[model samples]
Target chain A: MEGNVKLITDDGLRLDGRSSNEMRPIKLQTGVIEKADGSAYIEWGANKVVVAVYVREAYPKHAQNMDRAIVKARYSMAGFSVEERKRPGPDRRTMEISKVISEALSSAIILEKLPRAEVDVFIEVLQADAGTRIASLTASSVAIADAGVPMRDLVVGCTAGKAGGKIVLDLSKDEDNYGEADIPMAILPRTGKVVLLQIDGDVSPEEFDEATSMIVNAMKDISKIQRDALMKTYSIEGGE
Target chain B: MKYLETKEIVYPGDRIEINDLRPRNGIYEDDSQYFSEYFGVIQKSEKFIDIAPFNSPYLPRVNDKVIGKIMDIGPTMWTVDINSPYYSLLHINDTPWHVNAGDLTRYLAAGDFIYARISVSNEIKESWVSMRDTGMRKLEKGQVILVKPPKVPRVIGKGGNMINLIKSETDTKIIVGQNGFIWIDGEPDNVNIAINAIKMVEREAHTVGLTDRMGEYFKKLKGGN
Candidate 1:
């Protein structure tokens, strides 16, 4: 699977004609859902994801933490989102993504300030691309901030991988399927702290360093887009 | 440290550089650096720097006046929903009426609204609302509307000017809860006017000269009516 298909053409551009260090276009919008405390919608390349954040009293009478709030992130995909129809429920893969996303967000939110409460983040993927997980997490952070939940910083992420014997910034569908290695990374942009990092497939130590550095730099642009989306929603005319 | 301009929109994690001013609500300090914790507007005064969030859940504080709706009844207490994440408890002893245990419904039944003050709010977010304070009692014959809790102060205005104007102009009685629940009572038409005015305030709460704009708005409304 490593070199069966040509991901990078003779011109040194990937299947989408993007350079190795170039990312797909991403569009972010905040305050999209009126009923939700905070909401965001994102279109990253071909993947479309919507996220909502709800702050409520922790329920079940037992899951309540006396000292801080809990973060519960649910990642769900629509049946038609994939090339093959995905079953409409939380499968094992979805559950794993949900857990990682929840933990990653908990590190950024100031949950201690909201004692005995819970912040629920719902991520719905309307269209599936290769990097849905990172895109969903990015939108969830924006939604949480829009809900006005206190946080240390917004979480932003990107993916880099080795495809066609070349290190690439973002993985396309074909590259993800046939690529040699993939690494998804998320970080707190303010402090450059990595909150979530996962590696799949094989890469040498030097290649791993290059992949992570590429992702870290890409995350800065994503963070700027997140802030601009929030500013668009809350910016007042003549505001200083 | 970078100097942050006051009244500028800021998102969570944006650094706020203030010289010697203490961090207040909507801000947090880490490693001697201040950063905003909410997507809101920055406000700085002589002694403090705070962020006024565009929207946030209601967080109850001790001694704050609030309007609540009775959701469930118990033998000795009633569960009240004060528009916050935590449901407050209103005990029988806290009400003005002399009622015995197990007879709570006779005084304040489920679905009834009350005006009360938060008497106790613990570290765990458990709170108790008391109706023993002055002007605190069962709210009857009024309509309750909710705004974002963070906008309550702007609805009230500096020194209660905005709310007073709305009440006097529309000939209605309005009680603004610090938790964002507002009670408006009067003739149906006047109540509608008051509600509209309050909604306007909620929408433009961040803008300056809102009080003056509201004044002219009311005059035009009255002339048309």
Candidate 2:
């Protein structure tokens, strides 16, 4: 509150001039990288992320699952991605993010179909305002589909939280820094199954339910955008 | 049980049906419904429903013709990379001629390319390739190109018509391996023409009227010059 910034203006708009239920604009594109087996680039609000999937030899040979393929994911942030120059390599936060993302994506893929192989997904956050994890997860899901990995469904993720005693969807950087709570969630849009979820700060049971519904509804729209991008890339006519 | 129409593109989680049809490539079944796993065209057979992936990794199967590059020289065998997750072995016994124990490099060095066949393949081990009969031999001259493995069938066309058209039109000899590797041999200009045509086929494999379009394309190329 250095500038005593109001979380919302008197007109009920958030600091970024968005309604409490509004999310930032999102753009998703598949097959952006020519050399990768599958690739996608995403822009959500102020976050920019690119993900590439490689169909390569599975390493740490002993770890390979004989009945199915393993999905290994790595989440990395550029040194200049944030306001301060962060150090390169995996940090504690990125390691945790990578673990959750890999688990979420593993559920979407039909791993049993690909025996003794590995699909490596690398997510690079070039610019991060807030909700980088959700943006990265959304991009990686499209990349995996682009790679032609058989998946049970496409996953979409988003963030929601209580700001100034009011829950909001897709919080921006300012709201995230000063918001009362933050909840990051991901789901299999087709099944409405929550695959990844983490709550930070405080929220009552009623607030939790409201935030969950808000995020899920927003994710449905995001999933459609993801589908359109993929369909356009493959030149498939119309929507499903 | 009714199945989805053929050649209709399906995405992950899109339900094809709840019928008892056997699911094949790019499809998975659940307790209540059958869902598509890949983003590709749907193909239906009498007994099962399958999906032909637009892009996929190569998985070696028995009797598949492959073009490989020698990666390493072992004691009596040479390790070859067949553009797949699994590396194949070319044992000395599979070679057409006898090679003495002293030097195996004379037959195939570490950097040479070869046209071979997957003679033996199983889930538990690396696939073994043979240079025996099946027109398997060292590639002396040409450029190697890769297309999607699933699209290889389309590239060859029905009864090898597409390949024959390209070959006779461009005055080039082309060998299309089942593993999506194409070897072109001819004048550099003609080879380029053939390569471009093969790529166009690969990119538009799902489209209709491809053969006629390709014929017109070759005619145009020949007529323009």
How much does candidate 2 score in TM-score?
Answer: 0.94
Error of 2 at B54 (Å): 0.9
Q: What is the TM-score of each predicted model, taking all chains together?
A: 0.94, 0.94
DockQ for all models, in order?
A: 0.51, 0.45
DockQ of candidate 2, scored on C-alphas against the true complex (2 decimals) = 0.45
How far out, in Å, is residue A138 in model 1? 0.8
Clashes of each: 0, 0
Give model 1's docking category: medium
Fnat (0 to 1) per candidate: 0.71, 0.58
Interface RMSD of 2: 7.2
The best candidate by DockQ is 1
